[model samples]
Target chain A: MNVVGRRTLTVIALVALAIVGALTAEWWLSQSPDRPFGHTQAGHVLGWAGLLLMLLVLAYPFRKRHTPGQRWSKSLFQVHIVGGLVGHLLILLHAGAHLHALIPVLAMLAMGLVVVSGIVGQVLHALAFRTMNEQRRLLLHQGLPEPEVEARLQALAKQEETFRLWQVIHGPLTVTFVALAMLHIGGALYYGGF
Target chain B: MTWPPPFSMYPVLLTATLVLIIGLGWASARDPESFWAPGDLSVHHAGRMSCTQCHEPFRGATTANCIACHADATFISQPDSPPQIFHRQAARERARCLTCHTEHRGTTARITTDPLNPHSEFIFRVTGTQSCRDCHAGVQKPGPKYGLLNNDAVRRLVAKGKGAHGPGRFADCFRCHAGGRTGAERGS
Candidate 1:
């Protein structure tokens, strides 16, 4: 019906899907002859899927840049977040507890850092937006005109959004992940990986 | 002031990414087995730095690689030859090298020796199944196996066990005295 209702529904749906997916993965792993560790076929599939998802997540920045000032950019951002979360889950599943290789372990660590920093960025941005909205509502209630209220909100948003250090963390971590992943892939191939 | 545009650092990140990828490729190309290998290759292949010797580009080392090296009469002539026989068996069975010999294990020990069999660690080398307690005192108690037998003591232990157990009595020593079944079967 409304934006809040739509957003709430979307979040609930995503959570439900994630829970179901996790349960299904757990069941599949249980039935497998081997644990779904990275060495197993299922684990390899998950790792590949996770890498693909990371590629999608990496594409988001380009998507946003190319589609600047477009409404679809917001949807793309949401996709990026979902893709990143799913990718992280797949990777964690693939790794399980037995992270043995050096390059792959480093890649997993970089992926972890990227995912954590991304979540931090999301939380910080949400907090800033909420605070700005609350301040705007307060200004509006005090009988300020819409234009001045908007200006005040923008100023508050500017101040709060300045703490975008998450970008510094997120971007470099992504780069590191990509680099390590490449190294892992290259190493695997050189060592006779099919 | 506002933060710099997110894209501002793109050049740096790109450069770093390129540098790391290139650096890895350069190092790995020269010595892939030791560079990023999980474990050291078996002693048989340990001296080899080039992964390309066994592994094909992207497809990895197939039985073909083994065949390439050991398929000739030189390897086949010796029935008891461990490496050549293993390669021949693999070829007959159409087995992948990875089934028995996985790489990048971070240590060459895995390729050289079996982890499951404890007797492999002993340097004295028992000819047959013998009481482990002959060397490893107090190992028969219900706990972890005793530490490795001392090199000097190994010779003495082997001689003593051989003399005491002879061949028939010690046949099932591994069945009881080996780590898993407990020490109840010792000195039978």
Candidate 2:
């Protein structure tokens, strides 16, 4: 078999393991002859992965070692944003969309806020990327902060002048998102499972 | 056919539940489409595994995985440590992974930590605060042993209170706490 066929079989095996894991979880749930213990393990797999995945995605880019002026920055950030958004979707599913529990609710809210902030930061980051590119394209002074100057040097694309602003704004928003994410997890610890 | 209660059925029940769950999960895995969006890439990433990786598995399809991750955390019980502990066993009677997690339901469940125990307070007051009473009573021995707390006020402080300067606000602290920073309701 070719590489593709080999990879396909591996994927199939993983699926099989996942099914076994699920069934194992179900059995664990059923073990509580009197208390419904086994009954619950049946449903916890995805939520765990979702919460962790979102945090991992959010932290990956800035956590990576990269030069500020590198070309890969834009692509890296786009990946970060997409990963974060997808992770959040998984987390919501993991929680079963229930936040009635005070601690869990607060945690979920904090997580939600972090994701929203991440979204805003992604937009700002994109804007910054565009601005930096324009600054590069026009051969303007990297130190120069004026859009008009950048415009005059080039064809004066409206997009050119606004890039620096995005760069400046994204920094603070990303920091806030990180801080909120910590609080969300910490608060979840405080409230606990009943 | 042992009764599934207390300690007797622990092993059998656990095993049986495991088998049943394996079967159900196996059946669910046969289909790739049930796990995600039409052609979701993550499903492929998961190798077609069901959504139980991070979640807690219960009887059928519950998903409360929070407790599994946060069980050992002190935040689940009390904010501050008490002078006495009632539940001295330390997670002895706490809920199982599934009881607290119960998954696939929703993220909004009312997550709550167990409260601190009350008996520890009762035990602490009786032993610690009264430690000096033995020597300070002056009638027992000569008093000069290791010298930890003020043995002089032996008879008075226990009856009244003992603070840095002198005397405490709450009169019957030992009546509640039980012992010195140790008792039944330790982490409540």
Best candidate, TM-score: 1
TM-score of chain B of each: 0.48, 0.21
At residue B113, candidate 1 shows an lDDT of 26
Off by over 4 Å in 2: A1-43, A58-60, A63-71, A135-137, A140-194, B1-188
- Model 1 Cα lDDT, one tens digit per residue, A169-193: 6766777788788778777765546
Candidate 2 per-residue lDDT over residues A1-194, each given as its tens digit: 85445654574475446445644544454443222221133334555555566556655455443443444555656567666655655545444333333334444566556655554454455555466576565655546556666555456443453444543444444444444445444433332222
lDDT of 1 by residue, B36-82 (tens): 65545544566763666677777776767766765656556755433
lDDT of 2 by residue, B34-100 (tens): 3221122221224533444442222322223433544445444643232112222334555354333
Question: Residue B184 error for model 2, in Å?
Answer: 47
Predictions in order: lDDT: 0.60, 0.42
Q: Could you give the interface RMSD of candidate 1 in angstroms? A: 5.1
Best by DockQ: 1
